[model samples]
Target: MGIADLLSDVWGTFSHPAPDAEAPPTGGSSTSSPAAESGAEKEENKKDAKSDDGGEQGHRPSEGGDEEEEEEEETVDPKDTLEDECKESKECQPAKHHYDECVDRVTGQIDNDGKASEDCIEEFFHLAHCATQCAAPKLFAQLK
Candidate 1:
């Protein structure tokens, strides 16, 4: 019937469901792929740019055994990653509603407290957790 039905049927067929039944969902991208491909593509573009400038069409510098550099990869921020993922959704009201509620709640409070309410922050974070991390980096980079 639907994807959920198909997933349920396939999962049901497996006798041993494994020990970690409460594992988080793996959105849909391999951890190494986008990073690797992006590096390769970036190199390709750089080479192309150099040649297009009428300079000697020289051999592109090889990424020779750059394993160590890769190992020293920097960590990305979780909030930034979540923001990136949220941008890709076709439609999402949670963030907007959360923001509006925060504004409304603060404005209506009239307590002279110059702070947004906790309920708004909680709702926003809850909605954010549901966002997939697959396209986060790309989305964040583009926005920047």
Candidate 2:
């Protein structure tokens, strides 16, 4: 059969389901379609979401409320992070000693090899010490 005939037959059969089927019977006094109520609910949800976002940003807090204090607490200055890095690097005196030991170890390995040139050995130890004691994981990541 042609597509038109197939569609018409389906349309005729679909006018009503058996009375005991899952769906509520189609004929009713209600003015609204089920699809229309879903659309209206979507619009209401969008309005509620927009209102919440506006409350977060636009409405000015009156006289030191919880929101304003929370906002102030959340902010962090860039200098604070820089100061933290500086304090950590400066206060850790043991790392300098650790780096010196690393240099000595690498230099010893270089000297143990009979054919390695002294100048190349010095350069390798310098780099190896920096990579090890200063930033082992960072150096390993770069190698990978």
Candidate 3:
């Protein structure tokens, strides 16, 4: 539809909602649609659903709040963890330096197409391998 028609529909929705948007007339044979329920009524329905099945469908807390706190407390950014481990690893220094140099060299070189003339995938892989070896144990230990 055109923009004008779309805007008109939106305006009409706010200015004058559809008849079906209102709750069904009370004390009648008509069934109420879920959409017709108010927020409070919906919440009450959720509570009733919980009671119907012994609270299985209810909004319940985690089995142990300690687990939640432990998870939050131990949450470390992987990037930050890797960088910290790499900084302390002597074996990763040379590969990291080489990768940085290769990146700088490649980015500084421009071809006739005005793009990087070379990629440093090999250097990057070397750096990544070294870093992963140094960081894996420490990172994986946290998984448990």
Q: What's each prediction's TM-score?
A: 0.26, 0.19, 0.43
lDDT agreement with native, every candidate: 0.62, 0.54, 0.74
Candidate 1 displacement at residue 85 in angstroms: 6.3
Q: Candidate 1: where is the Cα deviation over 4 Å?
A: 1-89, 110-118, 132-144
Candidate 2 lDDT over residue span 1-144, tens digit each: 999999998997898576766865787654344554566566665666677864543233347665544434676754444433533464434444555565676678777974334234444454445434445444455558
Of 1 and 3, which scores higher on TM-score? 3
Q: How would you encode candidate 1's per-residue C-alpha lDDT over 68-127 as one tens digit per residue?
A: 454667988766766655645543455556666776787776566765454566666655
Worst 10 residues of 3 by lDDT: 53-62
* Per-candidate total of colliding backbone pairs: 0, 0, 0
Better candidate number, 2 or 3, judged by lDDT: 3
The model with the greater TM-score, 1 or 2, is 1
Q: Please tell me which predicted candidate would have the highest lDDT against the true structure.
A: 3
Tell how far residue 52 is off in model 1, in angstroms: 53
Best prediction by TM-score? 3
* True-structure lDDT of candidate 1: 0.62
Worst 10 residues of 1 by lDDT: 126-135
Q: Write the per-residue lDDT of candidate 3 for residues 30-49, one digit (tens) a residue.
A: 21577667787677767767
Q: Which residue runs does candidate 2 get wrong by more than 4 Å?
A: 1-90, 114-144
